[model samples]
Target chain A: MMGNLLEHMGVERDRLHFSWISSAEATKFVDVVKEISDKVRALDTDKKFAKDYTK
Target chain B: MDTCIEKIRTICADLLAKGKVQKVIGFAEGSIPMASRPIAVTSKEDVAKLVFNATCGLNLANYVSDVLPKEGKIAVTAKGCDSRNLVTHMVENQVSRDQLYIIGVPCTGMVDKRKIAALFEDEITDFIEDGDTLTIVSPQKKEKVSKKDVLRHNCRVCTHRNPVVFDVMAAEPVEEQSLDQPFADVDHIAAMDPAARWAHFQELTKNCIRCYACRNACPLCYCPTCFVDESSPQWVGKGQDKTDINTFHFLRAFHCAGRCTDCGACVEACPMGINVRDFTRKLNKDALELFGWEAGLDMEKRPPLDVYSPDDPNDFIK
Candidate 1:
C-alpha cells in the first residue's frame, strides 16, 4: 500500500526509503525529513523541461 | 487455582498435539532474580512450565505480533486488559480474528511490584499471596499488605473485569464498572490554559529518549512496515532534537487516538517519567464522547476512524 502511494506521488523507486522509528528517535526522524526536503528542492524542475515533458 | 492452571495446560497440550496450533504464547518465569517476561511454548511438555500469578502483569498480547505464525493458530492468555488489546488489533485489521485462540481470564487486577517495593524500606527477599492479602518476607522484616493498597493505579478504575471478547474464559465473568471517572486526567488537562497545556506537554515529551518502548508496547502498532522507517522519502529524521521528539510523540498519539485501548503498557514501559497515558486516555474519552465510539468493545464493529458517514460533522472545515 505504501509503495503504491509513493509511486502515485512520483517518488523515485531508488529514492524510496523505509524506517521503523520509535518515539525515542525523534531527532533522527526530523533529520531524515529535512534531508528529503533538501533533495526534493535540489531537483532541477526548469520551465522548459516541464513544457517539453508536457508537450 | 489448580483447576485454572490445569485447564490452561490441557487446552495448550490438546492444541499442540492435534496440530491445531504451532506455538502457545504465554508467560514463563524469567531466569533473572525478579523479572517475569513473556515466553513462547512450542512443545506440549513446556506447557507445565507456564504459570499465572499476581506477578504475571505484563500484557502478553504484545507478543502476538512478535511471533507471526504463517499458517497454524496460536493460543494466548488474556486478562480483561489484554483482551482489549486483541480487540484493538482486530478492529484495526492488523490480525485475523480466526487465527487466534484466546484463553481469557477474569482478572482481579495484578500487583504493581514497584509500588509494593516502595512500601517497604528494606529489600524484599520473597513474597507470597494467600488470597487477597500478600505476605512480603524481607531480610529485615516480614509484613503482610492488603492487595487493595498495592494494586496498579489503572486497575483501581478498571471497568473490564471480565474479558470483552474471548474464546474460552477460565473463570466466571465479573461485573463491568461504569465509565464515570474515565477521563479525570483529561478533564484536568482541559481545565488548563492553552499556554499552560503546551508547557506541560513540552515538559513531558522533552524527557523522551526515543526508545520506541511506547510503540513496541502498543498491541495495535503491529504495522509490518511503519511510516517512521521510510527512507526514500523519509517522513521523520533520525536525529535527537527536541522538536523532532515532540513531533514523533504528537504524530504517534494522533495515530493511536481512536485505536488506543488504554492498557497502560506504554506508560509503564517508558524509562523516563513521561505520562504517555494522559494523551491516550484523553483520545479514548474524546472518541467515546464525540463519536459515541468505544474501541475494542466489539469484534464486529469497524474502527471509528477507518470509516466515515455522510452525516459526520465537518466542524473543522466550517
Candidate 2:
C-alpha cells in the first residue's frame, strides 16, 4: 500500500520493491537485487522527494 | 434539525442519569459561527449543551480513546464517519465495542466553513441553518445560500451517510451520494506527468508550517511518538524546509494508507487551508480499487494492508 501510494504521488515505480525470499534462496535474492538496481538506474535521479537542507 | 438535537440531548441525559456510561462525547456550540467543537458531558445537566447540526464537522471519535475512562463506559455521538473511525479503533484495539454506546446521527453532510467564509469579505457574525438553506450574517449584509453549495468536498463524495454500526439511532438515515466519478480529484492528479504531479503536491504543501494539525485531528494517528518526532533515527527534519514539509505530508499520508475514513477532520483542522485529503485520498482510491476495502466498516476484519493473504495482489513485487 505504501508503494502504491508513493507511486501514485509521482515517485518512480522502481524506487520501492517488495519480495519474499527465504534464507536458502540466495540465487533468488541476488536476481531480485540485480533487477531492482537495473530498474532504479534506468530512471532519472529522484530530485523531487529528496530534501536539500543546504538551501 | 432541532428535533435531532432534542433527541440526542434526551438520549444522552438518560444514559448519563442512569449511569450507563461514565461520559458522553458530543458537540457543543462554538463561540464562532459554523464551528461546533467537541465536548465531553459527564452529567445530565450538561446534556442541554450537547447539540448536533451540520456545523458539527469535527469527528467525535478522535476523543473516544483519549477521553475514555479507565473503569467505565462512554457514550459517543456518532455520524457516519465517526462511527467508521470507532470501528477502526475497535479493529486496532484502541477501544472496545463493549466500552462504547454509539448514538448514531444520520449526517446530512457538513458544510465547509471555508467555502462559506469565502463568499463574504467581512467577518460572519452569525450563521443560521433552516432545512436546506443557510443564512450567513456579516456586518455588511445577510445572505442565504443553499446548503448543497457549501458542503465539504469529502462529504459531497461520501457514499456512507448512515452509520455502519450503531447502538442507537438519532434520526433517519440520509441518502448517500452516488457519483459516477467518486475519485475524480485523485484521477486528475494521477493523469498528470510525474514532474507535474510532484510540483502539484509541492505547491499544495508549500504553506505547511509543520503544525501537525492534520495529524492531531486524525484518529488513526495515535502513535505515542510520531515518526517525525523520532530523534535517535531522525526520519524528517523539524525545520520548515520544503523537503521536510513534503516528507511530513508524504509520511503522514502513508501512515494512514488503508486506515483513513475520509472524515475530513484533517482538512477542517488545517489552519493553512491546505487540502490534506489530496495525499490520503489517493491511498483510499488505491485501497478501494486494489483491495476492495474501505476502512472502519467491519470490526471483525483487519485492514487489507495490515494483514497478508495468499491471494493478495503483488504485481509490484519482482
Candidate 3:
C-alpha cells in the first residue's frame, strides 16, 4: 500500500526494492544486494520526489 | 431522553463538586436549531448547560488534545468513535489517560444538518426524534423523515455504536450493527482503472477552496507544527495550486494511516460537502485488510504501524 502511495507521489516504481532474507544467508543476501544495485543503477538519474537543493 | 440528560448533569455536578474533575467538557444548546456548541463547565451550577442529543456530533476528544488544561482532571463525553479517538490520543501520548474522566454515551446516531437542509431546501427550523421517526420543520412545511434516512452517512454504516471504554455509562449498551463488507465504498474506487481513479479523485477535489477545516476538525491532527506549516523544509507550497492541495490532502490522510477513527468530524466540518472520507476510508480499508486490525477499538493493542512481527504480511515487500 505504501509503495503504491509513493509511486503516486512521483517516486518511480522501479526505484523501490524490497526483499526478505533471514540471517546467516550470506549468499542470498549478496544476491539480493546485486539485484537491488542493478535496479538502482538502471534508474540512478531519476529522483522525481527530490528537489534541487542548489536553489 | 430525560434519563440521559439527568444522568449527565448529575454525574458532572458530582464530579465537579466532589473535587474529582476540575472541569466537564460536553455540548450546550447552540443558537441554531440543529447544531450544538462544545462548552466547558467549571462549576456545579453550570452543569445544567450540558446537553447531549443528536446534534452533539462534534468530537469532544478533538478539543481535549488541542487545549492542554492548566490543572485538574477533565471529564469528557464520548460516543463510540470519540472514545476510540481518546484511546488513540492515549496511545499517541497526546493526552494522558490518568487525567481524563470519560463519560461514555450510547450514541443512537447524529443527524446531518446539511442533509436536512438539502432535503428541505432550507435551514432546519426545528427537529424532533421519537422512536425511529424524525419530524423536521422547515420554513415551508413540517415533514416526517425516517430517522434512519437523516442520519449522517458514517453513523448509518457504523459498526461500533457503543463506547468501548468509559468511566461512567450514560445509557444502556446499544446493539452493534454487523457489516458484511465495510469496504464497499473504498472498493468502488479501487476497482477503477488507474487513470480513471486519478480523474475521479481530481473531480472529487475540484471544488476544494484550500480550506483546512477538515484538518483542524480531526483529533489525530494535533501536531503543533503540521507538515503543511513547516517553513524550514517547505514540504508543501502555500497556495491554491491543485497539485499542492492534492498533495496536502494525500499526505494528511497518510499521516492518519492507522489512527483515524472514521468519526465523520472531518466530513461534518467541510464546507464544500466533499466526502474526504473517500480518501481516509480507503486507508481504513487497507489498515484492516493488511493488518487485520481496526483502530481505536482496542486499548491493549497498539496501532498497526507501532509494532511489527516477523509473520507480518510481506507480499508487497518483494
Candidate 4:
C-alpha cells in the first residue's frame, strides 16, 4: 500500500520493501535484514533519497 | 434542508439549556456567501446561529479532536462521514465515547464549491438547491444543474449517507447512493502505464505549495508533530522541490492508508484546487477490496492496520 502506489507513480520500486517479522522471531528479523541489505547492495545508489537517512 | 437547520438549533439549544453539554460544536453562517464556519456555542441564545446547508463541505470531525473538552460532554452535529470519524476517534482512544453527544445529520450530499465556480464563468450572485436541481444565478445568466452533477466526488458514489452511529438524528435518512463502480477513477489511473501514471501524478501535484492544508484538514492526522516538521534528522524537506513535494504527499497518504474515511475534508480544504483525495481514495478502494474493511464505520472492530490476518493475501510478498 505504501511504496507500490508510489512505484506505480514512477518512483523506483527496487528501493522499497514491505515485510512483517515480529520481535520474537529474531532469527527471521536478521535474515530479512540481511536479504534487504544484499538487495540494496546489488542495486545502484538512489540519488533521490541519498541525502537523508533519518531511520 | 431547512428542517435540518431548525432541528440542529433546537437540539443544541436544549443540550445547552439542560446543561447536558458544555458546548455545541456546529456550523455558524460564514462571512462569505455559501460558506459556513465551525462554531462552538456555549449558550442557548447562540444556538440560533447554527445552520446546515450545501456549503458545509468541510468535515467538522477534524475540529472535534482539538476543540472538545476532555472532561465535559460536547454536543456536535456530525454528518454521515463526520460521525464515522467520531467512531474512529473513539476506537483510536483519542476521545472517549461517553464525553460525546453526537447529533447525526443524514446528509443528502455537500456541493463542491469549485465545481459550481467552474460552471458559472461570471460571479454567482445567488445559489439555491431544492431537491435534485441546483439553481446558480450569475449576472450573465441563471443556469440550473443537476445536484448530483455538482456533488463532491466522494458523495456521488457514497454508499453510506446515513450516520452509522448517533445518539439522535436531526433528519430522516435519505436513500444511500449505490454506484456500479465506486473506484472507477482509481481503476482508470491503475490501467495507465507507469509512465502515464507518473505523468498524471506529476501534473496533479505540480502546483502543490506544500501548504499541508490536506494534512491539517484530515481527522486521522492527529499527530502532535508531523514528520514534515521534524527537525532532528528531518524526514521530509521543508523546501518545495519536486522530490520534497512528492515525498510529503505520498508519505502523508501512506500514513492514512487503512485509516482514511475519504471524507473529502482534505480535498475541500485544498486552496490550490489539487485533486489530492485521489491518493487517499485509492487506499480506500484497496482497503475495501483486500480486507473487506471500510474505515470509521464500526466501533466494535479495529482499523485494518491495527489487526493482522494470517490469511491476508501476499501477492506482493516476494
Candidate 5:
C-alpha cells in the first residue's frame, strides 16, 4: 500500500522494491538485489521528496 | 429536514431525561452563517439546540472518543459519513458499540460553504434551506440556489447515504448516488507522469499553513501522540517547509490506509481550501479495486491492510 501510494504521489514505482526471500536462499537474495540495483541505476537521480535544508 | 431535526431533538431529549445517555453529541448553530459546530448536550433543554442541516459539515465521529464519558453512555447524531467513522472508531477500539447510542440521520449531502461564499459579494448573513433549494442571504442581496449545485465534493460522489449501523434512525433512508467513475479525480492525477504528479501535489499543498486542522478534524487520526509531535523522532517538521508539508500530508494519508471512509472532514477542516482527499481518495480507490473493501461497513471484519491471508494479492511483491 505504501509503495502504491508513493507511486501515486509521483515517485517512481521502481524506486521501491518489495520481495520475500527465505533466509536460507542466499542466491535468491543476491539476484533480487542485483535486479533492484539495475532498476535504480536506470532511473535518473531525482530526489523529488528529499528535503534540502540549504534553501 | 426540519422534521429530521425535531425527531433528533425529541430522541436526544428523551435519552438524556431517561438517563440512557450522559451526553448527546450533535451540531448546533455556529457563530457565523454556513458553519454548524458540534455540541455535546447534557440536558433535555440543550437538545433543542441540536440542528441537522447541510451546514453541519463537520463529522460528529471526531468527537465520539473525546466526549465519551468514563462510566456512562453517550448518544451521537450521525450522518452517513459520520456513522461510518463511528464504526471505524469502534473497530479501532477507541470506543465501544455498547457504550454508544447512535441517532442516525439519512444524509442528503452537505453544501460546500466555499462554493456558496464564492457566489456572494458580501458576507453571508443567513442561510435557509427548503427542500432542494437554498436561500442564501448576504448584506447585498438574497440568492436562491439549488442544493445539488453546491453539494460538497465528497458528498456529491458519496455512495452511502444511510447509516450502516445505528440504534435509532431519525429519518428514512434517502436514495444513494451510484457513480460511473467514483475515482475519476484520482485517475486524473494518475494519468500524469511522475514529475507532473509530484508538481500537482506540491501545488495542492503550497497554501498549507501547518495548522494541523485536517488532523484534528479527522476521526481516524486519534493517535495520542501523533507522529508530528514526536520530538525524539519527529516525522515531520513544524514549519511550513514544502518537504515537511508534503511529508506530513503523505504520512498522515498513509496512516489512514484501509481505514479512511472518505468522510471529507479533513477537507472541510482545511482553512487553506486544500482538497486533502486527493491523497486518501487514491488509497480508497486502491482498497476498493484491489481488496474489494470499503471502510467502516462491517465491524466484525478486520480492515484488509491490517490482516494477512494466503489469498491476499502478492503481485506487488517480487
Candidate 6:
C-alpha cells in the first residue's frame, strides 16, 4: 500500500527508507531517523518536490 | 456448557431486538473440528451458535478496528487479554469507549491449538472441554491433558485477570497474577553480546515473507495509514529483499513501543516462526523501567511516546 501511494504520488523509491529499532535502542532509532532526515533534506533542491511529503 | 450458550443467545437476542447493538461479534464453532473462530452475528437466529470455552483464544478485540458500525454500538466478546486490548485502544483514543458494548468472560486460560497439534503426529478427530481439562480423540488413541499444560505461554504469567473495562461481565472476575518476573527472555537477550544478538535476529528474520500478519494481529496497530503503507514519503521499501523485511519488522516493533500489551498475537500469527515477542517484550520492559508505566493496565494513563518530557532521560543521545 505504501508502495502504491508513493507510485501514485510520483515519489522515487530510493528516497524512502525504513529501519527497526528496539525500545532499548533509543539511540539507534534517533540515529536512523536523523540519517533519514538528513537524506531527505539533501534531496530537497531548488525544485519544490511536493510539500505533501512533510507529514 | 449448553447453559452458557443459551444465556449468550438470550442476551444477544435482547440486545439486537432493543436496537442496543447493530452487530454482535463472538466465536462460533469453526469449519475445522476442535477449533473456534471469530464470527459476526447480525440476527437473533445466529446468536444461538455463540460459544465460550478454552479454545476461544483468538483476540476478538482485533475485530473492533475491522468492523465499524454505521448507526448503533457493536457488541464484542472479550476474555482477559482481549479486554486489556480494548482498554489500550480506548487509552490511545483509537476507539471511543461509548461506541462499544463489551461482554467480558473470565478466562481460566486459552489453549494453544498449535502446541496441541505439535504434541500429536496423527490428525485430531475430535476434542472435549471438561472444565480445565481437555480430552483429545484421534483414530488411533484418545488422551486427556490438563488445560494448564497446553495454555499459551503468555497466559501462564499474565497479570491482568479481570476485564480492565467492560459493559457487562459474564462471570466473576479472577484475581490478577503476580508478574514479578516479567520479561525474563528480554534480560537473557540483553545479556548477549552484540554479534551473537545480531546473529540470532538474522536467523529469526531471514525467512520473513513480509506477510504483515504480525501488524494485522496486533491490537495497537490499528492505524488506517501505517507508516509502512504511507507512500507520500515512502517510509519503507516495497521489495522482497531480506533487508526490507527486516526493516518492516523493526519499524513496526518500534511503532508499537510503549503501546504494546505483550499479547504475543504477532508471534502466534507469524508464519516464519520469528520470535516477534522478543522485541515487543523488550519494549514492554523498557516502558516500565524507564518511564515506570505499563500499557493497557490503566486507561487513564497516556502512552510514553505520545507525550515527551523535557527532563526525560536521554542516555541514548550522543
Candidate 1, residue B102: lDDT: 90
TM-score of each: 0.78, 0.97, 0.87, 0.90, 0.98, 0.80
Q: Which digits, one per residue and each the tens of the lDDT, describe model 5 over residues B134-185? A: 9999989999999999999999999998999999999999998899999999
Tens-place lDDT per residue, model 6, B1-318, is 334556667778889888899889898987876578789998888887888877776678899877867556998888778888888888877678888998877777777777787768899988788877789988888889999899877777677766777888776777777876777776676666644665566677777888888898788888889888899998777766655665686678877788777676787677776767766676677777778877777877777878788856554443
Which ranges in model 6 have alpha carbons more than 4 Å from their true place?
Answer: A1-55, B1-6, B230-233
lDDT of 4 by residue, A1-55 (tens): 6666676666567667778888798998888888888987887665543444453
DockQ of each model vs. true complex: 0.02, 0.72, 0.22, 0.38, 0.79, 0.04
Interface RMSD of 2: 1.4
- Report RMSD (Å) for each prediction in the order shown: 11.8, 1.2, 4.1, 3.3, 1.1, 9.4
Record all residue pairs in model 6 with backbone atoms less than 3 Å apart, i.e. clashing. A2-B229, A20-B250
Model 2 misplacement above 4 A: none
Computed on alpha carbons, the lDDT of every model, listed in order, comes to: 0.71, 0.91, 0.82, 0.84, 0.92, 0.74
lDDT of 2 by residue, B1-318 (tens): 767898999999999999999999999999988889999999999999987878888888899988999898999999999999999999999999999999999998999999999999999999998888999999999999999989999999999889999999999888888899999999999899987888888889889999899999999999999999999899999988887888899899989989999999999999999999999999999899999999999988989988999888888766
Q: Between prediction 1 and prediction 2, which has the larger DockQ?
A: 2
lDDT of 1 by residue, B209-287 (tens): 8888888877767777666777878777655566567557766776787777677677667777577776666677767
Best by lDDT: 5
**TM-score of model 4 relative to the true fold?**
0.90
What residue pairs clash in candidate 3, if any at all? none
Candidate 3 lDDT, A4-24, residue by residue in tens: 554433355667678888898
Q: Rank the models by lDDT, top first.
A: 5, 2, 4, 3, 6, 1
Q: How is the predicted docking of candidate 2 categorized under the CAPRI scheme?
A: medium
Candidate 5: stretches off by over 4 Å: none
Task: Rate residue B2 of model 5 by lDDT.
Answer: 79
Error of 3 at B95 (Å): 1.9
lDDT of 5 at B290: 85
Ranked candidates, highest TM-score first: 5, 2, 4, 3, 6, 1
